[model samples]
Target: MEQTPLEIQLKTLPESPGVYQFFDREGKMLYVGKAKSLKKRVSSYFNKRLENGKTRVLVGKIDSIRHIVVRTESDALLLENNLIKEHQPRYNILLRDDKTYPWLCIKNERFPRIFPTRKRIEDGSEYFGPYTQMRTVRALLDLIRSVYPLRTCNYDLSEEKVAAGKYKKCLEYHLGNCLAPCEGLQDEASYHNQVDDIREIIKGNFGASLTYFRHRMKELAVEMAFEQAQAIKEKIEILENYQAKSTVVNPKIDQVDVFSIVSDPTHAYVNFMQVSHGLVVRSHTMEIKKKLEEADADLLPLAILELRERFNSDTRELYLPFPVSLPEDLKVVVPQKGDKRKLVEFSERNARFYRQDRFKQIRIIDPDRHVKRLMQQMKTDLRLSEEPRHIECFDNSNIQGSNPVAACVVFRDGKPAKKEYRHFNIKTVEGPDDFASMTEVVHRRYRRLLQEGESLPQLIVIDGGKGQLSAALKSLDELSLRGTIAIIGIAKRLEEIYFPGDPIPLYLDKKSETLRVIQQLRNEAHRFGITHHRNRRSKSAISSVLEGIDGIGEKTARDLLRKFKSVKRIRQASVDDLAEVVGPSRARKVYESLRE
Candidate 1:
């Protein structure tokens, strides 16, 4: 056998941690991945049978392999992320955010004006944040303005210009909003001191600002300037109120970065929060679109690095939902309990909310995409070989064995297909035996669909536990559809999902979309079944009541019901009213039976 180019490259691959790339015969990049060991990781592609369909396809197209050996796994992770962003391989999860986030820039100038800007210049100025929202920037700037009077005008405020009195004090000076640095009213040292305090405030450290304000207030009070003291007191109150709103956890927990991820089959949402002195100084959620099946363990590390880099986070301590491989310079804390755990949970909530908002937006703007993603998620969660585009759920309803009935609610593309909904009277099963009733309904439902050449559902949900699921499976076996269609039973007690022949049930997360959809299916089936059962019981009661009378037939009973609406109303009516409905002969018999 001739050695292929891929085999040749694989032989030369190093056993060092690095990033790897797969390329096709046409010299186009197909996929990029990071691995702890380049040789073992790259070789596994050929050694193992890839479970993901996309991964299998990606491997089949690969004609050559390339790798760059790095010093460590963290370096490889960083390198992999950079390559993916730069090249955007076909089989890499791309970070989808395109909007430029706003940042608070402290200009590198004499007065050092602070303002919010989307564009970042590489000048010697300091930038506090790439905050997720413009409102946050505005709010922070307002707080800064209220505490310290700083120059907002863009001018050359040099010592020589101020000595020469080149710039005039405008409305800002008269309004007391600015100390008029351009006209030398405020010295450089005094302005810089205020700037330092503002810097601490922006970093979520309000101690210095509060101390400065308190000291100023006391000094003015001693000078008998009550108005000035009152003004300073109000500014101190404003700063304190803002800090209280921003603060979340224990004040001792400072300079920490928290990250949490929530992912679906197609996309992952990673939320980042920067904490300083227990206050959330910055927060943002990054959305990454997956090109192949990726786990949270792989996705979170990449996201942490990307987010920390984007936000310029230098916090040594990190609160994460789970452990991931990262550089030793960063401290990864997977908080099991306490305030740190709460912070992680808070970050997770943000990610979940972002995912939900994106889902709602996608549902509104791109309904097909939303459906496709939902189907894919269901397929993965249920371990199905194919997406469950059309789903059917079965539920048996009976109250003390009176009227046994079943309902089959159809959901096409994860939405109720009302027209395809079905109702089944328990013909083969006697009493309220749910298992037998389920078996009868399942068999009858699919048999009719097969007989009529109608489309069968991709998945079937039984609103019961192991017993009902087993009964349904027997019907599927009889119809030779056991392996053809996917079926699962949901136990109401714990929401446990049971599969045929599997003793153990799969438990889904409470907030998962898969669980939600399955619960929806089960609820819909129960509602439909209960409705049909109620109607049947009502009709049966009406029939038994009127037919027991010797003179009353089905038509006569129906006529009485149609005329008076109910047996109670019919009893309330006089003989004359009864005769008007069922004629004189039958009316007297009905009146006598009722009176007895």
Candidate 2:
């Protein structure tokens, strides 16, 4: 709730990129919002009486307000994502996309194979099609088999059929699902040609391939090779199937996204759906808290731009957050007729439902309270030019002797600075010396930023107090980068803060919420950096064993390690199973070498 008399509050807020909070009486948070031009957007709320139910409820509790100006909308979006996650404000219609989309995976090997999966694996396989629909994935797999049935079984060829002969042809081959080239029933020369055809179809040049295949079909028939001609016909049919589905997409659109916004006075719910390659992939929601008395002309463009930034756009499309007069660059689409217009009504309804159903829990929190008190103590204790506006935090994570990763998260004006968040793979630091790790990350992060001519943070937050702080400070000093950045290390328990050159942890005034907020940012950065490091470490530990095995060169080791992520799992596999993965008859040797 904007606490101040609406007019005065509007004047007080600056017109810049930043986040603002509305508070009710008792200093409780009523709502939170970010904007490119705070003055314009915040002022608009006070100027007009919100007829929207949501706004009315939020406005009724107006009390006090605060603002934190930022640099860009990208920076603003990052802050918004982090805030929404941390606060879970009642009024925000959050889009929690826990559902990882399914995609097609083609194992990268001497003879690569294609398939579908919902889980993402960091393996030596080429992955494609994070297609939103399961049906879309299945359809492609079915088409691949019908058109050019490649191996679909996850079998150990060494134990299954390789021992019988170099190539005895599997069941699919005898059944005509496969070309039987393995058994030499179908010549390798001819089978390679079929593989070429399959590759072309997957690449989306179906029409040209279909035409070329048609000629092949006719030629086969002229030679009285009826079976070969029939195979060609099947491939053509698969191509046609894909085209028919894509035909539903309105040609006039090329590609487009339809969005609608339904908001009450307190919070605005922007509901959106995207259309690509003539199909709808997903729908998402953007939540904005009640506006303050500042102006708003920049909100619409920023919202749409953020939406665009989050998704892919290799295919041209329009992403509308409302029934907007499409901008010139947006391809200004007004679907007056046909299939395109029909979609508009459905999108519009989602918009309406989204608007009305945006039941949000609004809490106005003044982070400034905690941050200000902490800054004051720091000022009196060590003294500074001003309260820190931008604080950069660093942490390192890794398993014992494994893949190590580091993360740097920034907080600007008490809000997260996402555009500046960075990750690093631990290098040069041999063992898990937490100090050395922090030093490496700090050095790498700052050196690169300076080289790139990026803005430096006003303050630095190290995850640990004392030792970690000393390591980071010393690292910066060695690089001649220490003085400008105000350094502080936050101790976890009791939330103690240790500033540079101080052995004792500093305690801040209890009333300052900004201090607590900064501590939270530092802790979160530590958590994030460690989780990434652990994941990399686990993968590295698994990858290392393959390299140690004799005869397993980089590519081969990568292929095996990728297929089975860990050495323990591979160790449990029988010789036959191992052989099947790499080739025929090598499983015994592989098993022996890996065990050694």
Candidate 3:
């Protein structure tokens, strides 16, 4: 039920624990929230004293409200997190904090094996934390090296080597950090004792360690060994100084690794925050390729595995945009509220800093100038609805009907999904017919959706005139997916955009965000389609006989075909650099083969 009187909506709210919703006059779902008491929380907006940016905006347009009472606050928390994710409410803290990072793992089993890992093992091992802070982890490692003297070695030791004295200790051994178990300087029993002490240190039992050290210092001083006392005092100072330097606060808490991924179509920025108990001791950000598909949950796992494989680190809690299965021995924590929430929020904010740090514009070399202008002009005109959300665009490219191809690209919140970039090889259409090509691509795209029974797109843009749009609509109707998606055609008119679905072309006013986004999409489709087109053409262009000739191979041959298109031009190469068209390897072989 929807109503306009904000007071009436407020009166309907209950003081019970539940979730709430706010809607605009058009009944567009704007925000979804949860509270310990639904009535109190929902009515608080109408209370007139909750002067915050989000609250004020919500209050102003709150035509109606809905309530769902949960049994408890934890239920409310879970429901709210889910609802907010589903609705993507405007007011809630929308964080894309997914992407696991590496953490140090010590298996909680009978033989606790400590090593670097991002995966959480479920074998009943105590998980320490996600150490997100790089500096903190480094300092802690340095301290562990000096005080705990844990083994950093990872080499296999043969019994013969131990007996023959053929193996020597590494630099970590010379520095008196690692136990040098391979050198046989420390037996398993003694090494185990040191490892147990190291575990205590990671557990932050510095008070006990400090007490033991102080007692030893006193005992040495009483024995009149001045040098020994001085050395002990120095070691104690190192331990104390390390504790003071690391962590953002005192009274260190258990270890946790926090991870946040800041990303769009073009890039991904990952921020790691390692906390020892409640103190933040390490933090760093690594920029990753924005070219990955964020929509595929499986892809995220692969990306994370790749990242951890590249730059492995020990961590505890792994705060992410998505929940990942972890090891039983590790303690992964993220606060939904209170102190840990603040840290997670802060980490998320840091992840977003890359928006300004770098803006890489990957442009298309193809003649996407007009299609680009159409996108530019569209954003120049946002007359009614929220510009366009979940836009699906399509483009068709072919080579004289032999290899017809079409690509459909998706854009969300004004960014492209290069990872979701798909290609269609015009199976149903014959020869250079863009309309039929469009029909084939559209049918296949929606047919899958039909088989799956999913929600349709909000808008569809085609890289052609009215005919292309009609083809798309026919496909939608055929698949019973019409009315679910709106269609618009962006046709090029002699280097100008003709949005027949709209009134004008190249409606370039100024600072057009829609235009920029549209241009980005069209260019992306063209680039992707043409790239796929070129690759197809090249693969069919020549034989390995040319490859065996040495003067030409893959990259160079493609370049030669693209540039000169004939062996005559390639054979008449002016310089080795010119022959270097494919690649250096091909160029070298080509030059040598030519000399022969």
lDDT top scorer: 1
| TM-score on alpha carbons, each prediction | 0.56, 0.35, 0.29
Clashing pairs in 1: none
Alpha carbon lDDT of each predicted model: 0.83, 0.63, 0.61
Ranked by TM-score, the better of candidates 1 and 3 is 1
Per-residue lDDT for 295-411 in model 3, tens only?
424344454455445546465445555665555654545457644665566667655543332331122221243344334334436332333557788999886776788888988
How does candidate 3 score on lDDT?
Answer: 0.61
RMSD of each candidate?
A: 16.4, 30.0, 26.2
lDDT of 1 by residue, 1-596 (tens): 65555665665566777678888889788888889978798889889878999888888999976565445575465455546655677777553234344668889998899999977676777766545468988998998897788899999988888899899999999988999988888999999998998877876678988887799899999999999999999988888777422323443576899999988889999888877643454556899999888998999999999999887888899999889999999888999986689778877865765576567667655789999999998998999999999999999999999889999999999999999899999997777798999999999999999999999888999999999999999999999999999999999999999998899999999988899999999999999999999999998998889999996889999888988899999888888999998889889999999989
Highest TM-score: give the candidate number: 1
What residue runs in model 1 are displaced by over 4 Å at the alpha carbon? Answer: 1-247, 327-339, 562-564, 572-584
Tens digit per residue, CA lDDT, model 2, 420-443: 788888778887788888888898
Give lDDT: candidate 2, residue 145: 76
Clashes of each: 0, 43, 60
What value of lDDT does candidate 1 attain over all alpha carbons? 0.83
- Scanning candidate 2 in windows of ten residues, the lowest lDDT window is 356-365
